[model samples]
Target: MAFVHSYQDDDDAPAAAATSLRRMELLLDPSLPQHLAGLALSQRGVLTTGQLLAAGLNRTRIHDIGRRDGWRTPLQGTRMVAVQTGPDASQDLMRAWNQAAALVLPHAALGFDSAAVEWGLVGVPRCDGVTVIVPPGKELRARPGLRVLVRPLTTHDVVSPWGLRTTSMVRTLADLLPTLDRPSGLAVLDGALRRRVRRSDLATARERARGSNGWRQVDDLWELANPDAETPLESRVRSRMIDGHLAPNALQQRLRDSSGRVYARPDMTIDRHRRRRPERGPLYIEADGRGPHGSPGAAYRDRDKASDLLADGADIERFTWDDTFDPMRIPWRLRRAL
Candidate 1:
């Protein structure tokens, strides 16, 4: 039998026209994978496989796509995330959330570091698996990429700020505290406070966390988190310096020229005593967090500030997240400088 190319008669259109029309239908259908072309992949990019399945493909199709080099598998099972191909890009963020959700099973909410990405508090690492908190009764064994947490959370503790049904901000922060380093933990907390996740919500989480490890630390974390800290690292670093007695008071601080107003705000500062003289000049310490100032531009500006301080005859000491982790390094450095 002759192949039927089109519904219309041959007089109506050419064979090429019918083929073109068929191709057009495939492009617009909601079922097909919506691969965004030319989109860049960074540490901040991610996608979920469930989204692919929902895009009119089954497990077999997904496996085929993987086999054909159409996808990259970063993690196994629950940790699996699908990165889209080409520049425009196609990622199923919702599907990623759901996959993380499946691993947590009942009584879980997308939260902490994971929520920080969801709420845009910070960049989500493309390689890391999603973070979720499951209530005490529903904890999963530690999988390769999955960080399954068994904790306490009430119904009210699982609300999201952006109208999504993830864990509430307070609960998120409380859950994250012990799991993350001080800087990363504080980043999520700082963001939550800025969004004004009500005190009552945090209080409720605290009540639920009464007997948990690291639960007591949340109050201290809350008290030290300042509004000025836009990023979690900022607040946590500041908090650690304070706890370590390394933080400098603004009034006693001097970073710029004694005559000029624009000065560097170093992460921490200390006064050095003189051996022969009555007193030595104060030391200005800068905490070069993840990016110095977080990017190249920020680093350049900070360098200028440092130059200004140096011009003013101030001694400067620089440290990073690692220095903070080591208690003796900071003090020893200052002592040697002094």
Candidate 2:
């Protein structure tokens, strides 16, 4: 933990530039073990082979350490130390992924969906390893557990945070489009909007997105992204509804019982003409994706709120991730309910 410090863009640090291989060899020879250990700690238990060599360690010593129990070679030239809770955990895996990216691609900036998570603009519902967008002249070979995209980014497209270069929020959302399905893409766009990212920013990113694969799909979500969608799952569910040719009456619709008691906001409302009557035409269609529903508190709240509304003569229905993905279920059930 001694070396657990934030990473920085190399251009910002003069002393770090001094840690070049030959310089490191000379500087760390006297304290090889401590220096290497510190580097490993700083990188969330990951250390690069270049670092070991710079630390004046021979290939034989590097091999021995990598072979020790709990160590793993996740990528060429990179070694990950033992995880306290093991590598199966999402938080641990994400930390290691980011740390490894910093070690293996020091000049690369984190981009796309990964950067969105880092900015707290979105949730980590899925992991596709660490994504790094490299500048020109830096060649990164394709490797497992790591994704590298090469492009010349404008200053506006990237930002250095916690010492690591990452895509700016707008650029991250645009870059993230290719990695996501239409539903998730919409959700992320909604998130960006909810976070107050200007629509013009997305337009600029969209201009940059041209000629890129999947640009069309991502761009298509621009019109559908409503800030009213509260969660990624909700956005995805709404996308499915649209695909099935069923549009909700309203987004994030509010409701009150006959007694004027308000309830939780549902993802959308159906049959708008009955807005004045809770027991009639318009009802709520909750997008309780399985991931969120699994949380006891979330589950309790969803059910409790809906049940209370139902008792007061309100109508409600729900769909899960499975239901949305199932080609027949969601559309049919929704049609029947409506």
Candidate 3:
């Protein structure tokens, strides 16, 4: 009764094929304890108790499945039958939880960080629970790992791109920006811009949110949003730089050798004129995310780039995901280098 890990977009084909085989087996087998083939296939092995009952499983049978080794009741009445073991398991489980939330409260739409996750916005921190927003006066009790908020949402604010009722990208950003910390907020904005959420659209969203709580902060985040930021870590590094009055003069700035051939494109750059001590040299800041910069080959290339920049009379600084957390860490180093 070992459950198979659910398939995610980035999961290897073998894992997806395995999950598909399991799903096909569940669908084709009539002797299965719960005749929930259709529901299981559609919901990714997540089913509500109500769905279980409607699918002809009695309370006793449901209880038996709940006690089984591979099955779990993640929410009050939602049953999740999957092995939460692999790297993508948590994300798969999260999707299931979101599905369960939608199933349980068909009237409410996913909002806030949950909607951001649904929209695939980058820099969205992982949340164990789902956040659903209901209109004012709606009475919904909060369950374990489920948050219910009362807010006024118009038809324009909601969308179901994937058949899961959730906020639109603009609405999600508008609702989520103010709630996040400064660095996280800027990161989300930069990510949204990278995803092609136009600056004008964000401006309109900001204007609509005028006079609301945290509007100023949202506006500031909108101003800081740059499509040139290629990653959440880069956006976060820029945020810290701005916080410490060390904002870079350019992002993804290109460096050229004497022959005018592009050598390296640093994540952030400050020209010598912008430097506190112009004689020190131009500064290049690298926001090194793990995936691209962690490999040995990447490390070698990075060293080569650093050497070339150093030889060119440029001061180089590299920051990682961890370095951005300390507000003073990046700024202090850059200041000393400057």
Candidate 4:
């Protein structure tokens, strides 16, 4: 049998054949130099000028290939690949958008909320542009399709992994530790530890982070995000309480009343401080980072538990995110309360 042939041109009687060929090429090779893959494999099909250049295609060849109807550069000197798809499509566009920015900036890495999404800390809706963290002195000119963010980072803060410079796994989690609630922060810490970023690495990063304005919080997070933590929320709370000097008692210390009713153990407990005035008594401490007491139901349970402690002639003091930030104020507040 002989093959059938059809001919069509820009304005031919049946000009759709040319368009059909282009569509077939897209179907076969989604990795086209200037083609934006599609809604299905959004992250897998992005190509950049550098990628094309690596494949032996020069700018002139790239231009010639796109001489006719081709991909548009949404930003001047920046190309965008628009594949044929529904306007309303839910795409896993984060990785692709980030890849584009990485390709353009080459020096910046995704950080903060951007890296949190990559490292599984938070869920983000589909975004159009890339969020990048660049070295302090590097400035990228404004471009139409790209939203450039120049997050200043010292050399110690940059980590090169998988051939890309990103915030180190520990540093990425540390960056979000202060902003994230307890459970979320615990989740991020768990993820990082599971990926084999060690506590020692976190310790080192924290040590280096000193003198940096926001880094004390990072150190606090290190203690809070313990890899061996079975009860992460409680652990975080305990660490914060100890940092605030509110937990004079050892972590996981056991306790019992005069009647021998054992308290399994409080995260932290301080024996009552007997003041000259009967009103000043020893107090118990609880750490209230985001996770251990994050949910409304959990908060209710905690309130009930605190009420029980009060009934037992124990005053209870709790610490939170603010306490972690300014730890010195905690002891003062506790003294006044006593």
Candidate 5:
């Protein structure tokens, strides 16, 4: 309920509100601009100048509304109203942020990793800021905090998830495949498959990507993806092994002692058949080579398990995040252990 600052007074209120949705919502009258308010609800309570006109707010009245209501233009020609909320703003990804960006640009849709995040996809690369893909010929300008891409988007290639215009899940994955390494791409596929998206979901996407630049890589990931992967770490480990041409014998393979006593289920396993060199022997690998070992008790338990595995004559290799990123380390270590 605080008109923190006046928009007409030339204060920096607009810029401040642009980055904070809670503050922006506080300035809008939900009852007056019914359509704009409804649209803004999906756009982080932020509206564009064009949307204002669509809502029946004339140019003069729009200016009057801006001055009277403290509407700020964070980006040129964009308008926002601040609402009230706590000082603790989360840095975690917000769907409303992308909605606002898309709503600002005509025919703009969130694409690639942007769409993937909106669909709650897991195991892809960590992305920040916003990415907006506009249909070719749309008059949109690049803005800070937004990456604008122009492409020819087809009917099947686009979707509206989270009430925001974005590329379809299939198209989104295809868009992201080339940008990521094989392992990172598998993580995305594995995550999607875990959510029950099968190879069938990608049929149209595969057809569309025929002969495209990264089609081969995407195709490989589609076939190589295993829903058994429970985490991004696991997918990354599998990817490195594949890169080294060391396909696992089985994912999440169960381990047992001579008497069939199940010990631990490592993320991946190499059976006698999958072993490239018989001398290197059977292998079991854990994605978390480095233990979080939050407590001394936890550390002791892990050490105990390691001791047991050693006694069983199992060749185990542990890979950490650092090892996964280094092209030489994890693959080379895995090869040596195998």
Candidate 6:
């Protein structure tokens, strides 16, 4: 399948090809190395075959160097190249791939999970392919590690932050939430809210998406989103609890002493009044993701906090990323605790 540039018809192909040839010829000047370096830097070490050609390298030379050197062609059936620089190269691979996609398809805007990444929104799950949305009636065939879709988009729905065209954060959430399951969807919403996305903007996006597919899911998840969720894992756990009919009475509830001095704040709290038995006191749940809770100092503090809460006649439960994989695990354990 051939990738067509925006606004180019069969009649324009010959002119476009000639223009490309002339551009390549001009790029083969003595300053080619500098041009190639700048291009690679701008793209985070990713280069296209056209770029290599412009730098005076033939396809055979490009392929040989790529195979011999540490350079990687991340996207198959495409001319995209990623130069593996260091240990963190894999971390930036997706970003570079997204940049390459934007470069190749200038009229397309990064959408869905890829757009969420560009917007720096948390809780976006890893997707295997890059997604871009073109104007309705545009035809871009899907390639390996790349997803192209045609969707209606207004000028206000797109942005070019850091020079990469991407769907606005609100539009991205509206387009993305419905495609995910409840736990994942709520996590993304919680993450967007945590990033200070206004609820009014989200409401507006939801209303605009009213008649679209997955609109109901988006509407329902919006109501459940909580800004108090500090992390994606916490949001997922809370969502699971809600699904199991054990939504917490309060989130990030402050624990204070008899003197009214705040001592600890748990990730979530369930009042005994909300449980079947009121004699057992409140339940505190801590969602311990690896980053914040894995350190030796953090471990000591957690133990101390647990001791204090236990002494204060409160039941406590701590969960990690693994515990959230099983949808029923948290609810069952909390049920037993209650």
Q: Which candidate comes out best when scored by lDDT? A: 3
lDDT over C-alpha atoms for residue 137 of model 2: 88
Give the lDDT of residue 103 in candidate 4: 56
Question: lDDT per residue, candidate 5, 1-338, as tens digits?
Answer: 33332122112131122243333334665446545554554455467788777777788988886888777664556665554343312212334446567665647888876677666676667655577888877847787667888878899877653456778777887677777777788888888888777688766556666676766765777778889988888898888888888878788767677899887677788876566666544688877734454478867876787777767666788777777787677778876776
Candidate 4 lDDT, 63-136, residue by residue in tens = 76555436444334444443433221223244445545655567777766555545534312235565567655
Worst 10 residues of 4 by lDDT: 7-16
Question: How well does candidate 5 score on lDDT at residue 99?
Answer: 51
Number of the top-ranking candidate, with TM-score as the measure: 3
Model 2 misplacement above 4 A: 1-41, 50-62, 82-92, 121-128, 135-137, 257-260, 272-279, 295-301
User: By TM-score, how accurate is candidate 6?
Assistant: 0.82
Q: What lDDT tens digits, residue by residue, belong to model 6 across residues 42-90?
A: 5655677777877788888777666654465556523443333443334
> lDDT tens string, model 3, 1-338?
44233333322231122232222122123445445654665775677888777767789977876675346666788877544455445555666777778777889999888787666676877889889999988868988898998888899988876668888777787778777778888888888877677888898777766676777765677887898999999999999999899999999988887899998999999789877776667899999998899899999999999998888778998899999889899889988888
lDDT of 3: 0.76
**Residue 166 of model 6, lDDT score:** 87
What would the per-residue lDDT of candidate 1 be over residues 263-310, giving only the tens digit for each residue? 656654555443122344556766666644689898789888777766
- Rank list by lDDT: 3, 6, 5, 2, 4, 1
All-Cα superposition RMSD per candidate: 12.2, 7.5, 4.6, 14.0, 8.8, 9.9
Prediction 4 global C-alpha lDDT:
0.52
lDDT comparison, 1 vs 2, better candidate: 2
Local distance difference test values of all predictions, in order: 0.50, 0.67, 0.76, 0.52, 0.67, 0.73
Better of 1 and 6 by lDDT: 6
* TM-score of candidate 2 on Cα atoms, chains taken together: 0.74
Task: Give stretches of model 4 more than 4 Å off.
Answer: 1-107, 120-139, 142-165, 170-196, 206-248, 251-267, 271-282, 287-300, 307-312, 319-329
> Which tens-of-lDDT digit does each residue in 76-184 have in candidate 2?
7777764534322454456566667766677788877567656656533567578788888886876887888887888887777556677887677667776677777
RMSD score of candidate 3 (Å): 4.6
Per-model TM-score on C-alpha atoms: 0.62, 0.74, 0.86, 0.44, 0.70, 0.82
